[model samples]
Target: MDDLALSVRTARPEDAADLARIYIESWQDTYAGVISHTLLGAMSPRTHTTRWQATIRTMEKHSGTVLVAEDARFGAVGLCSLGKARDGGCGYDGEVYTLYVDPAFLGRGAGRALLTGAFEAFKDRKLRSCLIWAHAQNNACFFYEAMGGRRVATRTTRLLGELTPEIGFGWKRLAARKPARPMQSRSDQS
Candidate 1:
């Protein structure tokens, strides 16, 4: 964290609105030119708030997790949602469905903290390997690459009637990390 004083914690239901706002904001900042302007224009915090509320509750039943990264100076700067891998072909045990740092907090180590938190969440579920998908044209790929991710696969996903190219980054073996909360063992959680 390098003096960032960032902390990661499981998200609560009340956080949906804020998470939604950040999600939309981050998307607007990162995907403006990458995705269709019409699609982005249609995104609203109201719909996402409901979506995030359901996601937070549904993940509990599915062994998935939503973690928020908070800095001492800024409340909730970033978040990550991850769980068991969805595609069997990927051969990864865990996958990150969302990982974004608010644009205002982009360069201050929030993204790195979020990735580290994702690994920790995966460890909690006994997952040893992980993968994350990013838009092929998105600049976050370099951040993932710098964080030790390898470009292993590519695919196109249909989003808002457009075929959007994406790249999948993977980690075959994740190094162990210090527990987010010291009171208990992560292995005990699974």
Candidate 2:
């Protein structure tokens, strides 16, 4: 659907459920073959709901920010989390912990809105640079590259008892991010 009636705003604890659904579904779709099947299959919306709730409630205390992309027709369709870098050696002072968009909205503007909003948040926080890690095998690595992010490092992390390679993408200038674009408009719906 073009003419996207979308808005980006701070995430609320009440968004836990919708965020959890998006997280679970997006993980399943994006990491099926990249991550262990056992790990991907074990993801639960209920568990993620609790995680999202705690993350939202304690974000301010941690100087973290969460942003959601809401569409008039789809409610909360995308989300992003930004905060101080978790890895001390990442060289970036800020990090995007998570960014996910509903599969139905993937080709739309939700993902870009969430990411750009996160960059804006980082700049607002006076963070020098920002980093995000993705499974080395995930195609989203290309997305990060397309967004002016450079691969700064690589690391291995244990997930579901399997060691997986993760690549860190960094943006040295958060303020350099381009303005987000709206979803493409169409005259007909498929």
Clashes per candidate, residues 3 or more apart or on different chains: 0, 0
Q: Give a tens-digit lDDT track for model 2, residues 1-190.
A: 3666677899999999999999889988987776777788889888999999999999878878889999876689988998999969368899999999988788676777778888888777888798999888888899888788899999999766678899999988776555366443343344
Q: State every prediction's TM-score relative to the real structure.
A: 0.88, 0.89
Full-model lDDT for every candidate: 0.83, 0.83
Among these predictions, the greatest TM-score belongs to 2
Rate residue 26 of model 1 by lDDT: 91
lDDT of 1 by residue, 1-190 (tens): 3344577789999989889989999988987877788889889889999999999999967778898888666678888899888978389999999998888877766677778888887888899999999889889999889788999999999755778999999999987545333322333345
CA shift of 185, model 1, Å: 26
